[model samples]
Target: MERTYSVLVFGNEENDIMLILKFTDQKFQSLSDFLNSEVHNFYTHIQKELEAVVTGQKEESDFGGNMLNIDIGKEETEVYYQMDDESLGEPCFISTDELYKLVLEWKEMEEKMRRGEDIFPVILED
Candidate 1:
């Protein structure tokens, strides 16, 4: 199946950070609530988890309120996403290199947003 991933970043009056993930037909998003100062911690934890996954130390990892499930393998990482009950798409297998690049892109986007810079969202397709 044709697979695509998109990240949508929004900067509003409240400095909202929304990272939208589109996997095939399903749509999942990571909404950051910066009020409690948890965004940094969230990204840090996710990066560590992703590293563990890539190093064969973790088999699976969950992100964003169980919206995504990542299964790590020797060559590719399978990602399953669900948005509510209406949208549940097929799993997408992303290569290790692609996954790592995507994570870095996300982190960079988040950093830009935090620095009060006007930014645009990035989309990934494979």
Candidate 2:
């Protein structure tokens, strides 16, 4: 028997990507340890990107109430929101309309990842 984790990169149904990391007890522990150490930094970057897109700012900021990373024992996962409303400044705003826009943006991002492009260090232009 073996245990594995599935990494699903959610974009649009048209082009969804996933990575499956299968590791032995030893390797899983090793990888898990490493990811846990880097989870915070990874989350920070996600938060920064969210801020940039939502606020139209080039600089990064703390992720006030966004759920960027989730830690599960020896594994971590990433989640993105279409609107960081708190940062975007309007708690009363309902942004269901933004879902389609985010889908397209995420689709493009997924394509880049398919090309083995570096996830961070690249900012999208408006």
Candidate 3:
């Protein structure tokens, strides 16, 4: 019924929900730009991504797991994202750059996990 969008900015500190926006725009750059623009289409943006994932030709996504899995092709621009199931909150968009970095980091972490190195939290330490 309404528009909504979510921005998932990786935080180094705790106690931050990042910024989630919901609105419509004639000119919106990156998702960051859309969120930074104002506090507005929290649903519209999310539905957009959902449509891509849910209604896409692939019909399957590697969102979360033990390994790093993300691929955004030309026909289908995919990226990692998440939303709180309990919170019923807005969906967060994982920027392409961040997604790539996360994938690489997660791959390394997964390898370490397989080797039985340091496997505890799935946090990408900067």
What TM-score, computed on C-alpha atoms, does each candidate reach? 0.55, 0.24, 0.30
For residues 11-126, write the lDDT of model 1, one tens digit per residue. 65565554443434332222212101222446676566667767778766645423554555546765555444424445566665566556665566666656756544444555
lDDT per residue for candidate 3 within 26-75, as digits (tens), equals 22123323233221223333333334554454443433322112344323
Return the TM-score for candidate 1, rounded to 2 decimals: 0.55
Ranking by TM-score: 1, 3, 2
Error of 1 at 14 (Å): 2.7
Which candidate, 1 or 3, has the higher lDDT?
1
> Pick by TM-score: which candidate is best?
1
Least accurate stretch of 10 residues (summed lDDT) in model 1?
28-37
Query: On a 0 to 100 scale, what is the lDDT of residue 108 in model 1?
Result: 69
Model 2 residue 52 lDDT? 53
Q: After aligning candidate 1 to the native by TM-score, how far in Å is the CA of 45 from where it should be?
A: 3.0
List runs of model 2 lying over 4 Å from the truth: 1-94, 121-126
Clashing pairs in 2: none
